[model samples]
Structure formats: structure tokens, C-alpha cells
Target chain A: MNALIIEKTEDSPGVKFDPATAQLSLSGESRPENAGKFYNPLLEWITQFESILFWRKEQKMDQKPLVFAFRLDYFNSTSAKYIMDIILTLNKLADKGYPIRVEWYYDERDEDMLDAGKEFAEMVQIKFDFLPN
Target chain B: MRHFNNPVIKIGAHETGKPYFSHTKHQHLHFSQNIMQDNNSLNAYEVHKFMSKMDILVAFTGHFDHQMITILLKNIRGKLKTTSPEMAIEQKVYCILVECVENVSKYSSGNEDSSRNGMFMLCKSDTKYTVITGNPMLNKDIPSLKAKLENVSKMSREELKQLYRQQIMSERETENNAGLGIIDIALKSGNQFHYNFKPLTETTSFYHFQTEIEINS
Candidate 1:
């Protein structure tokens, strides 16, 4: 599958999803004026990749485990909802037995970010590796 | 503390000679020169002292626009790093400020006759920081804004999470940030949302909102 990459901006986060490398990640701050416009493409790309991902796994051709890393220092609540959506989609794929794991990184000093990641970890079905930076 | 209905113009020492008030034909005086000259009592140094006593860190009042938002956020981020000891508290404060500013900017009527004017301030009180924002908006937007604020304010932590999830999954087009900005502020501030609306004119009103976040020591 083709990789989907979104460059970083002052008001948005950078997104990279490469099925080839089994790497999916989002980093930086996310406080966009219009969350829908910014996150819509990211969601659509993930959905497209999900279909191909499941189909590839069905063919018994699973190469490497997928890694989803979230390294956001600051994301408004609206952006948090979008992040949850991404996680939910990924968890559904994980449920299908496609090897996947989520890695959440936060600064050791940033308790709110850490708590947010932990909260999402508890709310979702998949377990997350909370890495403190 | 003083609320104003009409546009209050304060002429600085530099613009002293120019007519502060404008009239097409008649230059009839309304308030009087005595009140106009009373601004000599309003000293910038005294105002700074008062603001300092209240630990006022950031304050701005003007038109709300995209460029202004960016500049304000950048200034807040820089200021918070020095004032706040913990990164977590700084981040939370920044988040709340962003929401407040965005909310004010997003819903502002921006009418041609009377453009949307806004005021934003951040003050420190003991172990908490308060964000206060006010803007001129159409009176019609009040009901929906009130309903959303009341709903979020009433929700428990768990309920708020569920609502957030449902809203995102439904792909609803919100007024701003999918109407999730206010909810996010409430949740982060531990449900500290105080809002009021003052009638400014027949169709316009001034909306004031304040939220407090506990400074993590």
C-alpha cells in the first residue's frame, strides 16, 4: 500500500502511515481552527489502509508487526476525539489478528499528556506502551 | 469591572490634538470635556501595578482573527514556560486558552457596521490560573452556546469521554472544532466554566466566559 504522509504545520500535527514499513505515527502540536478539515484526510487514509491491511493479513503474508506511535505534546480536546477515532480503527484491525501495537510517548514532565494517553489506553480495547520522554 | 455598551475611545497623549469623536456635520458634545480629560487619572503604571497584583500574565482586546490567534498562542506558550514550573500545567493552561480564544473568534458575528471585538486575559490566583474571554456575538447564538456549555458542565468524566467519542464517530460538522473545544476546556479545567451574556443592543450581546485550571505545583 502507498504511504500517506502529512507535513507538520504550526497549527497541525505531522502524520505518517507506511504499510510498507509497518509504521504509523503522529507527532507535534494539534490545535487546528477546523479539526474536521485537518483530520478528515488522515481518517480516510487510515480506512483505505485498513482494508488493504486486513486483506494482506488474510493472505498469510503478514510481514512485520505494525507500530502506531503518538508523540503529541499538546492537542486540544477536539483533536483528542480524532486521535481516539484513529485508535478505535486500529484496534478493530488488531482484533482481526493483524499484528499491531500502539506506542504513546510523552515528556516525563508533562503529566496531562501522559494522563491523556493513559486514559485513551484504558478506554480502548488495545493496550498501549506508554513511553516517557 | 466597568462594562461598556458603546465603543469607548481613549485618546493617548500622542493623539491629543485630533478629535477623538467623529461627526459628519454637527460636533455636538455628548459626555463633556471634563470626563474626556479625566483619563489623566488613568495611569499606565498604576494599571500595571493593579494587573501585577492580580498576577495578570496575558491580556489583549481587539479584533479576533487567524493571525491574531497565532500570535497570541505563541506569546502564551513563551510566557507559560517561564511562569509555570511544570510542563503539564503549562500545557493544560495553553489548551484552555486556545479553546477560549478559538471560541471567541469562531462565533464572533464580525458584522460590517460593528465588527466583532474581543478581550482575552489570563490571571493567576494562588494555585490556579483563570482564563477570561469576551466577544460581541449575535443574540441568536446564545441559546445554542448555553445549551452546549450546560450539557458539558453537567457531564461526569466518564460521560464526557463517551460524548467526545460519539461526536467524533458521528462525523458531525460542528460550529467550531466540531463543538468539542468548549467540552475539552470544561473537562480539562475540572468543569470550571462560568459564562454570562450582557445585552449590548437589540440584535447583539457581549458574551463573557471564564474557566479556571489548577496550577500543578
Candidate 2:
């Protein structure tokens, strides 16, 4: 699968989802003027990844533990909804026998960010490894 | 220096063209007139002093857009980082500021075109920080807005979080009005907020929204 790499902007986050390495990450602030325009494509990519995972299963290819890292410093409410969508999508992927792990990195001083991660974790019923940066 | 024939002293303009005034019957017209004469040129020092007295750390009035909001957030981030003792409080304040200003840009009546007129101010007291925002909104939207505000204000923290999650997941939520932003604000500030809608006309009203966060320092 091709990697999805998007450079961060003043109001959007940097995204790098490498299928070969099985490491996906989003970092920086997210307060895009149009949250859907920025996030919908990423959600579609994840959905495509799910289809690829199914094809790999038919070929009996060993699945790697995919890690999705979220290192966001700040995100608006609208962006938060999209993040939740991303995680819930990942949760569905996990339910389909994909080995997925979510790593949530937040500033040690930003308890709100940490709490946001916790809320996502609880809402999706996923174990997120919270790391303070 | 255009004079009006009605003898009504124009203190300012409301909604751009409507004159708001002090009538000559109030007996303070002379003092107001004196200030108006001096107001031909604003005294920057006096304005600064007034802001300082009001404990206003930041204030802006006029048009707002995504680009302008980004610039304001950059400056606000720097200011909060320096003055706020804890990063948690700074992050909350910053988040709340973004919501307030973004709402201004998105929902202000003037935003029907490209012009988004609003007012924003961040003031600090000994124990809490207050954010104030005002914008003109269509009067027809007031009842629903008032109901939303009242409903959220009455909710508990946990209930607000639940509603936030539900709203985010609901398919009915739209790009422009998910109604999650206010829920987020209420959750962050613990519902320590107030809102008012003052009728500007039969078709429009000026909305004032203020939220407060206690300084945990």
C-alpha cells in the first residue's frame, strides 16, 4: 500500500502513514477552517487500509502490529470529532483481526491533552499507551 | 464634525448606522460633548490605561477570519505561556479562546458575506480568567441558541462529556454546526459561562458570550 504523507500547515497537522513500516502518526495543531476537507481523505485511506488487510489475510501474509501515534499539541472541537472518528475506525479495524496499537503522546504539562486521549480510549474501549513528552 | 438637528448627542453607533445617544435632558451632554471634541484624536495612553485598569490582557474588535485567528492564537499562546504558571490552565484558556473566536468568525451575522464583525477580550483577575465575545446574530436563531445554552448550563460535567461524545458520533452533525463546540466549552470551563442576546432589530440581535476559568495556581 502506498504511504500517505501530508505536511503540516498553520492550521493542520502533519500525517505520515507508512504501510511498510506499519507505523502511522499525526502530529501538530489541528484547527482547520474546514475539518472535513482535511480529515475525510484520511478516513478514506484508513478504510482502504482495512480492505488491504483483508487481501493480505487471503495470501496468508503475517500481520505486523500496526501502531498509530497521536502527538497533537492542540486541536479544536471540530478536529476532536474527526480524531474520534479516526480512532473508532481503527477500533473497527482491530475488531477485524488487525493487530493495532494506539500510542498517545502528550506534553507532560498538558493534562487536558492527556485527558482527551483517555476519553478517546474509554469511548473506543481501546488500551492506549499514554506517554508524556 | 457633522451636526445633527435633533440636539441628541451621539455617544456611538449601534449596528453601524443607528445612532445611540445621550439626550440633552440627562444634563451630561456638555461633558459628553467635551469628550467627543477630544475624541477626534484618540489618546493611546488613556486607552492603554483603561485596558490595564480593566485587567484586559488582550482585546480586539472588528473583522475575524481563519487567518486572523491564527495570528491571534500565536500571540495569545505566547502571552499565556509567559503569564500562566501552569501549562494546563494555559492550554484550557487557549482552547477556550479558539472556540470563542472561531464561533465569531463562523456564525456572526456579518459572515453572510466575507465580513465577520465581532469583539473579543481576555481579562484576568486575581483568581480567574474571563473570555468575552460579542457578535451580531440573526434574531430568529436566538430561541434555539438560548435553549441550547440553558440546557448545557444545567448539565453535569459527566453528562456534558457524554453529550459531546454522542454529538461527535451522530451522523446529523454538520461541518458548520455540529453543536459540539459549545459542549466542549462548557466541559472545559465547568459550565462557568453566561450568554445574552440583545435585540438589534426584528431580524438581528447582538450576542454576548462570556466564559470564566479559575486560575489553579
Candidate 3:
């Protein structure tokens, strides 16, 4: 499986999915006018990566911890559901006994962003490391 | 109806006790027109005094477009950096502004005559920061808007958080609309919304929304 890198736009976040590093990360602001159009490909990529993770497991090369990270400063109101969808997708992998956790980073000054991470934690079983930067 | 010109639009009666207003006389005085036109009711003196009373830091009212969002964002960033400056509060204002303007821009009706588009005003006082945005919207959208506002306004903080999570899991999302604007606004602004609706026609109305975020000491 190859890595996927989506450059960040003014109103959309950048997505980085690396097969070799076994980590996927999203960073920057997200406020797409058409959120479904922006998130659909990312969703497809995640589904495809799940199979690749399974394939990597078959190859006996799955020693690294698979991780996901989100470092967002601002995201639109409409994008929350899509963020939740990302978590539910990651939760499926966590359910399969994979060592996986999400890294949610927020500025030390922004409590609302940090609070959002806590709320997300309540909704899913996946381990989320809420880091204050 | 909001417009007195169209007397059939049953507005000023107040007999039904509906929480609605009629902007019949001031329809021409909308933000867009007030910015451009001079013949109507608004004047620079009154606008200045009004903003001064609110302690406004930044304000804009115009057609909701991509270029306008960019310019407004830049201007807002500059203002936040200059006045009542705090990184946390600035971030909060920016986030809320994005949501509020997008709520107007993304949901604004296709009607050609409504002069309010993504009209946003940000004001600061000793205790809190206030954000107000107005949009011209379709009458068909009012029921859901009112329901959402009423539902969230009544919920406690914990209850709103729970409902937010529940909504994410159960709702089917689309491209243009995700139906989370009011919920996020409520959650971030302490679950309170100051909202008003003024009918223009039987089918069109102007939706005005105001939010306050307390400046943490």
C-alpha cells in the first residue's frame, strides 16, 4: 500500500496516510463548503487502508503501532459529523485487537477544542491522547 | 408578512402571540443596502453610535461570497490581535465566526431581492464577546431552525454535549448541509442563542442570530 498525502487548502485540512509508518494524520483548518465532497475520498482511503492493515498483519510485519492524529485549529460546524465518522472508522480497527490510538492536539489556550476531544472520547472506546500544545 | 407593502402578509397583528417580527418598513434598510444606499432610514451617525454602544471590535455586512470571507477573516484577525487580545478568546471568536458566517453563507436562500447576506458583527465588552449574524432565508427552513434553537436553548451543558454526540452518530451527513451549525454554536456559546425572525413575504424571512462567549478570567 502506498502513502496518501492531500495538501491542505484554505478551507480544508490536509490528510496524510502512510502505510510504512502505520500512521494517519489530519492537520490544519477544515471548513469546506461541500464537506461530503471533501471527505468522501478520505473515507474511501480509510476503508482501503483497513484491508491493507489486514494484509500487513498476514505478512507478519505489523510490529509498529498504528496511530491516527488530528491537529486542527478550526473546523466548521458542518464538519463535526465527518470527524465523528473518522473516529468510528478508527474504532473498528481498535476493536480488532490492534494497538491503535488517536492523537488529538489542541493549542494550550483553546479549551473548547480540548473539550471537543473529551466529548469525542466519551462517544468511542478508542484511546485518544488529548495533547495540549 | 414582513413587508407592509404586501398587506396580505399577516404580520403586525400580534394576535397569535407568535415570536416573529415584521421588517416591513426597514426592508430597504438592510445591511447590504445600508452599506451602499443613502436614501433610506440609516445614517452614518446612528450606525456609529449603535456600534459604539455595543463596544464593537469588528463588523461587516455584505453579500456572502468566498472573497468576502477571506477579507473578513483577515480583518477580524487583525482586530482580535489588537483589542482585548488573548489567544484562547481569539481562537474562540475565530471558530465561532467561521461557523456563524458559514451558517449564513451556506444556507442563504437563492432569492434575488433579500439584501442581507452573511451580515456579521463582533463586539467586545469587559465580560464577554458578542457575535451577531443575519441572513435572508426561506420560510420553509424556519420550523427546523426554531425547533433546533428551542431544543438546545432548554438543555443543560451536559445534556447538549450528549445530544451533540448522539446527533453525530445517528444523522446522515450531506455535502452542503450537515445540520450541526446551531448545535455547535450552542455548545460553544454555553448553549444559548438569541435569535429572531422577521418575515418579508409569506415565503421568505430574515433570520437574525446572536451569540455571546464569556471571556474567561
Using lDDT as the measure, the top candidate is 2
lDDT (tens digit, per residue) of candidate 1 on A13-108 = 998989788798999989777777888888788778777777776787855877899989788767877888888888887887777789999999
Comparing to the true complex, what docking class would candidate 1 get? medium
Runs in model 2 deviating more than 4 A are B1-41, B110-115
Error of 1 at B210 (Å): 1.2
True contacts kept of each: 0.62, 0.82, 0.76
Candidate 1 iRMSD, 1 decimal: 2.4
TM-score of 1: 0.80
DockQ of candidate 1 against the true complex: 0.58
Q: How do all the candidates rank in terms of DockQ, highest first? A: 2, 3, 1
TM-score of predicted structure 3: 0.82
Location of the lowest summed lDDT over 10 successive residues in candidate 2 chain B: B1-10
Query: Which of the two candidates, 1 or 2, achieves a greater lDDT against the reference?
Result: 2
Name the lDDT value of residue A21 in candidate 1. 81
At residue A59, candidate 3 shows an lDDT of 93
Q: Choose the strongest candidate by TM-score.
A: 2
Error of 1 at A22 (Å): 1.4
User: Which stretches of model 3 miss by more than 4 angstroms?
Assistant: B1-46, B113-116, B176-179
Model 3 DockQ (Cα-based) = 0.61
lDDT by candidate, in order shown: 0.74, 0.80, 0.73
